[model samples]
Target: MEILIMLAILSTVLGGWGGLNQTQMRKVLAYSSIAHMGWTVIIALINPNLMILSLMIYIMTTLTLFMTLNLSSTTKIKSISNLWNKSTPMTMIIFLTLLSLGGLPPLTGFMPKWLILQELIINNNPTMAIVMALSALLSLFFYMRIIYVSSLTMFPTNNNLKHHWFFTQTKTTNMI
Candidate 1:
């Protein structure tokens, strides 16, 4: 149990810090998964029943985020910059989904973390709870960067290509 807890903490810290310098969206997601997995593992160590709950939430949040990235065929951070220009709604989805992925308040993603933190405190493990919360904050920094890129960036008129990614999005396709 001790070893597993350490691994979980290590994963959370590494994932939080590793993504700070990443350029590829996939890599960032991968790190996010690592951190999330750590959270799951930590819950398993302390409260085995909650592990399933955490995993389920992680899967849901990750799936939505990946779907949005897929919508834009997003690869590099630069690729995300033009997503808003093409589809405003998709861009909005990406923004909200990313926030949820970061475990901000009032999102599906925050539910599990909140439960886990509460569990930890109930178990008399405030230190672990603090670390987990801090790691979430660290991860949020990178998510905000992605959100900023997607929301504010646009294709420069002087692009080497004559036409930018053809604006296939005639109308903001209503999200299902």
Candidate 2:
């Protein structure tokens, strides 16, 4: 139990501090995942069932993010800065997804974090809950940065590149 607590704290801190200087969008997301995993681990110490739920939610959100990035061909922070110029709808999706991943209210992402925090407090571990909350703020900072770059930046007017028409594929195929 003592070791788990220490690992939880270490991971939370490392996840936040590690992403501070990352220019690659993937790296930022990876660190954010680490931080979120730390939260899951913290709760796992008290209840494994809750941890499973949290991990599943995290996986779903990450899958959505990676798929969006893959479709947009965005790998770095700078590449994503002009996403609004490429596709407004994709940009909006990415923005909302990142915000949800950041644990904003009324999103699926918030549900697990809320449950974990509640569990922590109920389990008589207010100190851990406080620390986790603070670390979460650090993660939110990066998420907001990504959101700003992807949605708030202006498109370059001097570019001569032809805009590609985006079409949604209605055909669903089995991957298996």
Off by more than 4 A, model 2: 156-176
Q: Write the per-residue lDDT of candidate 1 for residues 54-92, one digit (tens) a residue.
A: 887778778887888886798888877676666667777
RMSD of each: 5.3, 6.2
Residue range with the least summed lDDT across 10 consecutive positions in model 2 = 167-176
Model 2 per-residue lDDT tens digits across residues 50-166: 999999889999899899999999888777767777776787778788878888888788888889889989989899888887887777777887777655566665466655645
Q: How high is the lDDT of residue 23 in model 2?
A: 80
**lDDT, model 2, position 146:** 74
Q: Rate the local accuracy (lDDT) of all candidates.
A: 0.84, 0.82
Full-model lDDT, candidate 2: 0.82
Query: Looking at model 1, which ten-residue stretch has the lowest summed lDDT?
Result: 159-168
Model 1 TM-score is 0.84
Error of 2 at 78 (Å): 1.7
Q: Best-fitting candidate, measured by lDDT?
A: 1
